[model samples]
Target chain A: MSGKGGVGKSTVTACLADGLTRLGVSTGVLDADLNGPCMARMMGVKDHKPSSQNGAMIAARNAYGVPVMSMDMFLPEDETPLVWEAPSQQGAYTWRSMVEMSALRELLSDTDWGDLDVLLIDLPPGAERFQNLADLLPDLTGAVVVSTASQTAMTVVSRSISMALNIAEVEVVGLVENMSTMVCPECGYKDRVFIGVETVEELARRHGVPYLGAIPFNVGLADFLETGRSYIEMHAEHPAAHAILEVAQRVHFWLKNQSK
Target chain B: MALKSTHGPFDGSMSIVYECPTCSMQTAMLTNRAETQMVRSLGVKIGGRTAPEEPMETLRSNLASGQEVSPERPAPSTGGKCPFTGMVNDAIGAAESEPEKPVWTEGALARIEAIPGYIQPMVKRNVENFALEHGCFEIDEDVMDAVRGRLGI
Candidate 1:
């Protein structure tokens, strides 16, 4: 999934993996966001360490037995920050990008994923990394873009979609609107969180991609984040979980049609 | 070719004349030590040695007489060992000495073929690696099932 930062790309990735697994599809996730990797924690494999076998790193499994590989697994502690060793910090910018690319390459190639039907790579924000990933995985199936209802996120996410369709020349599976609306937990009332210039459905129509679905901003999801719980698993009947599962179903049908 | 003035000599700059081994096309450029080191670091070999330093009068006279004068410092010997070449040789040697990839039985190949083309490569590679790790020289349906069992899928 590719999108602007804070648009819930990681959250959507976790939910999709969970939903896909529940649908009986073998799915895995590669947390490509090196700087801000939260998949390990979100997938409830934060404390698991990846073991090496025959020069390939074994992926960590979540509670559902879904393999996950992320830079967060290599971190020593939650508070420990990721830092690259360099000769000097004066001009680290020039080489830091290359180092990050190399790290991503190693993660993709040197990990023993053990055969997965779907490997959802959770890309960090920005269109550049999408281009890098496209270059790395030539046969990339497609990209799923996530965006919030805010105009700022829409503006940035539109550019990302353009980069995927125009520059990367890959198919955009669909667009999923995250936090499209907020539901009042007290009274069960729905309201728009951001009064934007355009709705996500209009943006998807403009780009000519499928509008997967919209996930409501649920307080339960936020609490699950703090508790390291799978919201989709626990609250499968909730509107937010139902929307995400529908998106996953659409993606599965799309993949089935694509394979044919 | 004409000698182009690039950077100053104080920064370890020197005039280099490169003669192509194939076409004998001579090219001249003024480059500094920093640039040479940078190029060498990228695994490119720079030809020609630097000429010894001479008096300004002698240099001027040599230029006037159309006599080629070398730069102040000699370029390192092209015969010297290149770290890049050594690295490439080591990689090639490692590959040559490595064990052969395990063979996939017809049944196993058919099972892999049943997978989608996009993910077939990954699935095949993972299964083969798994087979190798388990000391299996031939991958069949049993090996495939074992991989699934190991992954608990």
Candidate 2:
């Protein structure tokens, strides 16, 4: 998952993980936010630290039933505002991003991922300096582009997709439009909050990529999300959960068929 | 991202980060410490040198923030004007002619040798300053010639 910062990348990633779990597929989520990770916070398990086993660190499972590890989990709860210089920051990047990527590879290779169907990699928002994962690991499966309906986000998303395709040579599986519409929980009236903006479907169509459909904005989902509860399990009838499940099913089908 | 500094990589020794904002194209110091620090910090494999634009005002502000000022001296107008830039290099030359500061030992000489070719000149200049302040030693003429050639002085 990739896009510019603050564009619902983590939310979509959470939904995807939740969807995969609902389908009875054991999924492992790796939060590759090297410098400053927020996945642990999003998963509401920032305090749950992982322990070391032999030379390697064991992955921490969140309350939401996803195996996750991130720099935030290791740091203090109030350490968010601390400014880290390049050197100290490098230690985190090496341990959290690069080494974590290596650990994921070893997990897939050495460990018996019994009955595991998919591994979801939750990447950072922007494709900045530390976003060279494809170069570091050549065995990266194709990625899904997460974007909002904003014009600037669409531009960055386009560049990110193009970059993954051309430079990284990773296939662009699809584009998921997050926060497409906000519906009133009381009246059930849907309002195009981000009206007149190009959705991910439009972006995919323009770039000759597959449009993976849109996710509705819901506050109940947000509350569940903030409280680290599984949205699909809590609100099975929610529009956002259904949309994400459909996308996840399509992704699973595509990946499975490609293996054949 | 521990920097795997083998010999083959650019090592940022020969590659200098030049701030060519003005016509003079002033050179910025890409010290071994700075280069390795940046590489580790960024954590990406930089095949070659990459130049980022820096403003003079920003640099000056940084110097001021550290309570350090450029040594106050006129540039060496050996002729009436600077033969190179024609703007006064006199500021730097004048500072050079003043009483030498106490020398640090050749403690960092071996370290400098590990650096790439292009940056050797600055290290040589530092060594020359140290030697002159302590006591000048005559050894190899070829090395002196190479230093002069590289520095174009």
Candidate 3:
């Protein structure tokens, strides 16, 4: 999954893994958001530590049995801060970037994802890091681009989609418009709260990528995340979750088509 | 001569395991980029994940059946240098699998470890070569004496 930061990519990813596994697909979720990783905690595997073989880490499986791997799992403690400030010495940043990218590649290629039907990668935001991941995995089936329905988010989202389509040479599986509306918990009324004037469907049309669907801005999403429960698991009837399941089905279909 | 292929403790890092052929000494290399890249690109599997086998899988299996698995044969020389090991000219570059580690007596490996890494491989190679020439795999104190006598040292 690729998107701007805070655009609900992690939630979308978690729901997809849950839905896919429920649908009988052996699924794995790779948290590639090194700078801001949240998938482990969001998947309720925050305390799950990986087992080691060779030098590579085996991802810890959550209660849902979805194998989850994140760079943060290797960190000493949950509260330990990650500060990657550029050094003052010449070529230090270049060296650091190379090492960082190498680490990223190792995470992707080294993980023993055995017989996974689908591996949903929760990528860090921006085209550069996405491009780095693209370079690392040549066999990626495609990407799911998440965007909030705002002109500002669309501009960055479109650029990233183009990078994936044109430069990365990976398919843009579809576009998911997250936080498209706010659902009133008491009355069940849907309000188009934060999508600005335009919708992601229009953006997807312009980009020529398939428009998967839209997710409602549910306040309970935050609460569910805080309590380490996936929205799909606890609130399957929630509109946002329903939309995410629809997106997952589309992805499954797309993957099937690619196989054929 | 049971062969042992054990990796550096599992840490999600690319592990380099040195499989000892005769005495069965297992040394892990923490795998350099070339080693890791080779395995991943070839899709070389890990524990309990090996199936729908690929070319490298066969290579590894055949490699286990007394065939040499030279993960070092095609090592990409980084601009006439090795950036992974951070070494420069005349240094014996770190190798993933070198098959021919001339047997060292109890204190010999420790002594070789004391040598600077930049020159240790060269020293090891030279000593191994000396042993091979004399058909002596075990380089104990007596073999060292023979080598010293031969080198006029």
Candidate 4:
């Protein structure tokens, strides 16, 4: 899953992994968002280190038994937001991007992911940065682009979809319109809280991509999500959880079709 | 939904999020750093880097309303000026200073020229960048192949 920053890409990723795991599907969550790898904290494995065996790295399994790997796992306590300066010979080409790309490549290839039904890679949001991983994983089933139900988010997400389809040359499976509405659990009042030029369905239709439903605002989600607990497990009966599960099902069906 | 982001991703006015690590700066599309704290207070981690402290009210007002932050610094320039078009260019790549230009063999120059005119400058710059990166003075078929692979052209 990938999209512009602050698009709930990580939350969606964690939920997918959690949902997929519950369905008896072997899953792996790859935290490809090198700069700000929220997966570690979100997966409730912030300090979980990937064990080095022989010369290869082994991904750490989270509480849900979902094997997870992130750039954060490789860093020491003090070093966060890995700052690596590219040499002068390399056109100020953010050496950190290249380094993180290499690290991601190594993580994807070298890590003993072991046979899994799917490996959900949570990617950083950007055209060029996301494109860096394009050559590494050419056989991607498709990308699930995430965005909030807002014009600014959609604009950046539009670029993400274009890059995935054109530059990265990856199939865009669908778009997730997050924060579609905030429902008052007490009064059952619905409010379209975020500012969006058009509905997410309209945005998807305009882009010629599949419109995977939207995730509503859960009043408890703010504090609940910070707990690092899987959303599906925490709020199995919540409307938000239902939406995520449905999205996961669509992704599964899409993957199955791609395999066929 | 719960994990607050400094200034929601969409403000109907912003499109590009700037992530500058060195200066510990980050701007999301229309969101500026002045509101970084308010965004953080909203429980949204703005960037991996900590934002330098500023007035809370300004940040609060900006985050609350998605208004443009005051006294905002202008964005960084592209710096990549085109040699042929003279417009800001990324295709042309780093301009070659006299001391830095690698010596291209006659065969390599011929090979480079043989490429279509429209793409020659880009290919030449890419090849030069590749050569400079690898510290290769000579452009053999192997070097040419490496450059092609590196540039994916």
Candidate 3 lDDT over B1-153, as tens digits, reads 222333322111334345568766776555443333333333323222312322222222212111122321232334333332322111122332333566788766776676545344435655666776577888876776666554433
| Candidate 4 C-alpha lDDT tens digits along B1-153 | 111123322211122434565664665434332242223223232222133322222222222111122321212224323221111111111221122567878877888877655445446756765686688877766778777766655
Question: Over the stretch A112-164, how does candidate 4's per-residue lDDT look in tens digits?
Answer: 77789999899887767667667777777778888887778887788878888
- Chain A: TM-score in each model: 0.95, 0.83, 0.90, 0.89
Prediction 4 global C-alpha lDDT: 0.62
Worst 10 residues of 3 chain B by lDDT: B59-68
Say which candidate scores most in lDDT: 1
What docking class should model 4 receive? incorrect
List where candidate 2 sits over 4 angstroms from the true fold.
Answer: A81-116, A129-131, B1-31, B35-153
For each candidate in the order shown, give its overall lDDT on alpha carbons. 0.70, 0.56, 0.63, 0.62
After TM-score superposition, the amount by which residue A231's alpha carbon in candidate 1 deviates from its true location, in angstroms, is: 2.6
Error of 3 at B93 (Å): 13
Arranged by lDDT, best first? 1, 3, 4, 2
Q: What stretches of model 1 exceed 4 Å from their correct place?
A: A225-229, B1-153
lDDT of 1 by residue, A1-260 (tens): 55688989988898898888888889998999977889888887887765667657778887778888888876555654455432122344554565566667666777788878999999998889899999989999999999998999999999999999999999999999999898887898889988877999999999999999999887667547434456777886899989988999999999888989
TM-scores, chain B, all models: 0.37, 0.23, 0.32, 0.35
State, as a TM-score between 0 and 1, how close model 2 is to the true structure: 0.58
DockQ-best of 3 and 4: 3
DockQ preference between candidates 2 and 4, better one: 2
For residues A1-260, write the lDDT of model 2, one tens digit per residue: 65588777778887887777777778866666644566666676766744444434456666646676555544344433322222123234343343344433443333222345677777777674224667666877778788888788888888888888777888877888888899887898988757555666778988887878788876666557756778777777888888988878877777777689
Q: Give the clash total for candidate 1.
A: 3
Winner on TM-score (3 vs 4): 3
Off by over 4 Å in 3: A1-3, A54-56, A83-91, A222-230, B1-153
